[model samples]
Target: MKESFNKNDYGFWNSPFQAKDLASKSISFTDLFIDNGVVYWGESRPDEKGRNVIVSMHPDGSIQDETPPEFSVGTMVHGYGGGAFLVKENQLYFANSKDGMVYHKNLNTKEINPVTFPFEGRFADFSLDSKRKFLYCLRKNDSTQNQFPPTEIVRINLVTKETEVLFTGSDFYSNPSVSPDGKKLCWLQWNHPNMPWDNNELFVADISSENIITNSKKILNSSVGACYQPIWSPKNELFVTFDGNNYWNIYKIVNDSFEIILEKKSDFGRPMWISGTRTFSFLQEDILIVTFCDNGMWKTGKIYLKNNGFVEINNNLSTIYNIAADNNQFVMFAGNSLLALAVVSSNIKEPFKFKILRKSLDDSFPSNYISEPKEIEFTARDNKSVYAFYYPPFNPEYLKDENNLPPLIVKIHGGPTANVDCLMNPKIQYYTSRGFAYLEVNYRGSTGFGRSYREELKGKWGIKDVEDCLDAVKYLIQKNLVNKDKVILAGSSSGGYTLLSTLVKNNKFLCASCTYGIADLIAMTEHIHKFEAYYDQSLIGGSILTDKELYFNRSPINSANEIKTPIIFFHGDKDPVVNVKQTEKIATALKENNIYHEVYIFSGEGHGFKKAESIVKVLDKELKFFQKYLSN
Candidate 1:
């Protein structure tokens, strides 16, 4: 019998959505907490109203009903106001997004009560100083002005209903970890013009009996690079992971001095900012089990603090989002073939048992049929090393001619700073299975490599990222893995900007496609979300008025005359990040220039393609466009 693959298997299957269209699905891990001998994890489900819901899952692989508490409505979905649930004894305390208030829920009584605090801000984490009866939280001030200072740390007395500001600044603050003894508080902070990966400071403060912050000292600030994801050792000694000197390494504070624990060129931290959660699991003994992503694959390893060595435990998992450990056992949310819990002995020896919680894909697409991506490193124009995942063309039904290598689609990930990992991305598979080789580029400014490499595209966003894509294409052609004449460039958001810039800068690409991409830097800077309003300051430089020529030089819309490749553009009418007007202006220019181009706009979608129908349509249109232009 022939194996069958269902392309339209759309529903919330794995985390909340099916694996085939996971790329477009709005899924995130939330409410990871230990409760009643089981670990509970909450996830956001897709809904028309964009209501943020949390799904509770047990460590033994049991999922509870999708809980959409009354507070989820009208909350920001993209990294905004969703509360992190914390269960203490029989009661649960979590922040309510609806009113920007913190609430407590009784698991035993099923009763919910609002904690008396009048504040209009998003609350992230809460650390209870049990001895002093104080709750420390990282709160983002929701003052609606044209601009304001960054987020701050606050402390609240649960009994008195009194709130006190612990720390305030222009620097963004997050991940407040109170020491095991509740004597010292540790947190991470990063300033403007630099994201967390660019530069950050680790601070430790003495917690007074009155819940006041005292003797706050910068424990670890990156002199050469940035420090992030500070995790305190069980003994209350400061342990932090930082990319100092262009390499991510683990360091411990001993006698107020830094001691290198584990050093590697690979990344222990993810590309994005770290949530207030544990990355490393402390076992029964002194075994430090941590998950790290190298190249693109994620591995769970055990680090011996005494000998300063790490041994890989599970090498098959693509990404381990979270890890939890108890006395004699350990559990982790391991990703790859499935999102499941890996139960193992505290020693981490012998066979581990995996309880599958979520399976993204069906069994129809077997391992042999799936395309395996190979890591490729090439030199860019500045001799900088660029990393990319090259997925070779593979289709059981398709027969290929000897001379006809598969068409290539070069994918530029958004954030330009975000590095594409080896996740089981069906978006890439959708093209690869149809005989298109896909290359996802982690160009300069992409995190995971280190600070120096990430800052390589600081003032050269359009130029450097474009060059990296071109260089990757050249490398593939030289390796004979892809057809040089049939190479197309594709990206969304920042990647979309890179795609457009590549089309204008070079004529090598036969076609270019972008979704909600920026065409004008000036327009983007003028009208952008508050989270990244000053993004251009770090990306391209000052305002268009201050650096007029630089803005024009970086914007593909200004250099559209140089673009000879046929372009396809997709934008959402509701996209506030990269406004649809950017695409409209470019489409108008394309029409005036008589450049063969097409633009598609989704009515209510935002920066990303959200709706299932919209996602399928975009994929279909993109594939058809490439086939029409490149294949012929």
Candidate 2:
């Protein structure tokens, strides 16, 4: 199976992975749950206008779309929605995006009915407690108050449809889990100036026999860094993930003290951007199943709590989500070595067979054309260490020219709070296969490293992110690995903003390509959604009210005149996060200054381009734009 390496000029520009091949007809799984030998998840179908529906596996092993065409089982709460549906005893409870009402569906009868009154409010991060006859959830509570929003944790009676506020006074609340006996409630709480990742508290409350919370106390505080996914064992032991020293690790509360279950540099928890995120589950309180990220590679493992030992479950699986255990078998949606996936459930015992229940994609792509990224670590301009993934250009038939260097396309990931994992991304491969050496920078402030490293760009967003990205490509050029003259910058959302920011500060790159990126920090803070309203406050050191000059100084629009290269921008007209007007303003500025730039707006797209046509067009246009500049 070994083949020869291509020796043609780098950036050869011809490969098997083309723009036309970008359309993936297969479904992508998200936020799945497993119960009683049945698995249910949301299927993101790009070909269906980016429509998302609940999908479930039948008893006969057939897969069916559970949510009808008229209903989209999604939530708008927190802007980024997940854990939108809960299943109990063959009944599905979900809040549809169309009506913002919780709907109940009988899985056996295939009949659906509205459970909550039709309203403009949104709900997410739900849990069903059949014993209390209540569905606990985190709601935005627009129907109550907004100017001083209190993160409302409400319980809806499944029978009477009456909503009662269980807890309030915290700026944010999530993951309201009820104990099996329905006598205790545990949830996550964090005030403003701190996101769930920055700092959060785990609160446990005693519930009365009448379904009332009598007393509550914070079991874990902000000194813990951040806490997530507070759940109780069958024996009523409190379990949570906490970042005590530098990494997110699991611990159990026993006799009012923390008992470390597992500790490592890896992250057992991710940022709680959306609700209902879990990285580990306690099976019967003795056997623990965990998924952790070691340098952006996700792996599932089984931990023996007694010996404090662990064994990795599957090595080839890249990304695993929605891990739940049923008896001796665990089911989860996982991406395999081929970058395609299915609902896989495997027995915990070794030598047990791994069964693929339902497949999401079956492209059967040739192995020769796929280029896997290698982890790269280098010193930044600040003399600090930085991490990124370097993907070398590859082609089975064409050889790179020894004298010509490969073009570099540096990607800046959004969230800047989030890190890019080592998963096989077709989008990056589409360019890498065609001769572009890609580098995905997990710049300062990006998570997955330790806490200090992630908060390095706390008040230095534009400065640190831009520095890390430039240093990455500079490191490549100094090492004679890539063509310095043809380097390009690309990112989406915050990454897009950094992409544009890089262009403003440096002129070495050929052009900048951004999708729905931030052009004005001031504008973004003013109009950004509720979930991220305080984002710039933390990223920019403070809000405009506190740091007016820095806000203006950090925005890309202030330095738009300094751009020395062409730029191409993409925006979805329907994007609610960063308004389309932000993109339009930048486009108008480019015209006024006579700077070379092109702007293409999609009619029905949002913050992220999800539609097949939008994705295909963006890829094609960006490719053409880069090619035009490289030739010049």
Candidate 3:
């Protein structure tokens, strides 16, 4: 029963892909931690108001009782939080997002109590000391008056409810790890001018007789490029992942000098957007397992320290997001083209046979409708080659005429700094299954290629991104691969900005649909949070004070009067990233200019849409609008 070639034709929205499917589909796992024999993870469930629920998995692959329905274990570290929950034995320590307080719960007694005093401080990246009855963590004080948020390391007396500052004087701090004997502490720090991924240092200090850190020294200097994730081996040797050579590789410190342990031209680490992240861990004293992104796909492998040999882990997963390991096994949240995101555990020796503990995909979804993307590379502006995942309309039941090209949707991913991975994203397939060709472009600034490629958009954000996106659409049309007249542009967050900017500047697309998107570059600086206060300076080349005209000229809203095509804007009323006012202003401009437009504001949603009903309504509206405008 092979699909299509022997069957009838089916088109976009003609199959089982539904708008409700997007509402229920949740982000798999943000972070994972393993303790004793259980694995704990934070899940972003939109059905639950996008609450980050903490779930535990047993060794036998059984689902344990999740965190109390009232408690969603998440941290507000750096605005985008990871390392939210940590578990030691039957004890659970987590930062509650609602209150910004760290709470401890006894798994046996089912009792939860706050350990830190209530304040505006957010605590995360928990490091437990089994022998000292204390827990160490990174804390960020969100001060209202101060321009820069202050970060410090603090230790909490679990029993006494006392908090003591261990270290301070850093603009940002993360990964505060304590040695097994609880005698030494090590962590990562960086300043305001540079983000963690750009430059950082590792520090280590010995514990004193009075239970205070004494005589700390910088083990990894910032001049040596970005270094982070310092972990003391069982033999007390320090190992870290650094991008000293433009490639984030594993290095072990020997006599205060780095000794390359696992050499590869791939990223063994990721951008430090949050407090805690891990790419590898010691599977045993002599063996370590790690995951790295070579191009855009993720793969896992184990390094044998004894022989300095590397062996790839044989698995069906295309992406290994988070990994945690013990002496005998490794657990991770991984995904492939066929399977939705799932939490799976594998034995250290085999590393192939996996047992699924939990998954995001349900039985109701149609696997046949999922569109498998084709890797595409097209020459763009400045003679630079751009990359994208081009997915044509796919349905097992549908066949189409070769000459009757399908409509196209050029999707711009958010995080103008982020890149898309090779995985089965149902949201992307939603359009492809309905007779729409989809393209997820990797512009110049997107990561995963190399440091040089990522830095290409440093001061060319709006220009390069807009040029490359339009180039992608034009590339497909020239080859007669798509319907030139029905091509549309869409994206969220920064992606939305790129889409709208393209629509306004080139007047090439039929219409544009953006969600919580940025329009006014100058206004973005006023609305963004502390984590990204000077972000525009890096992307736009100068502060608002120095380049007022440049910001105004690049803003898409300034060209709203030039827009003759219909546009629809979706914004969260509570969004703080790019404030709700930015989108509202564009909507106002569109209406005043007599342009066909629609605006839907979700009340409780924040920077990103979070509720199931909200996701459903916005998506349905966007699809209907797409259909209405494309019909013309």
lDDT of each: 0.68, 0.79, 0.80
Residue-level lDDT tens digits of model 2 in 353-469: 467776665464455776777778999977999998888887676665576688889989998799887766777777887788999998889877778888899989888999999
Candidates ranked, most accurate by TM-score first: 3, 2, 1
Best by lDDT: 3
**How much does candidate 3 score in TM-score?**
0.94
Clashing pairs in 2: 7-399, 7-400, 8-399, 8-400, 8-401, 9-400, 9-401
Estimate, for each residue in 267-309, the C-alpha lDDT of model 1 and write its tens digit.
7775433354456756634677787767656677778877877
lDDT of 1: 0.68
Model 2 spans > 4 angstroms off:
1-21, 24-26, 58-60, 144-150, 340-342, 351-365
Per-residue error (Å), model 2, residue 370:
0.7
Off by over 4 Å in 3: 1-12, 25-27, 143-148, 220-224
Q: Model 3 Cα RMSD, Å?
A: 2.7
Task: Give each model's clash number.
Answer: 0, 7, 6
TM-score for candidate 1: 0.86
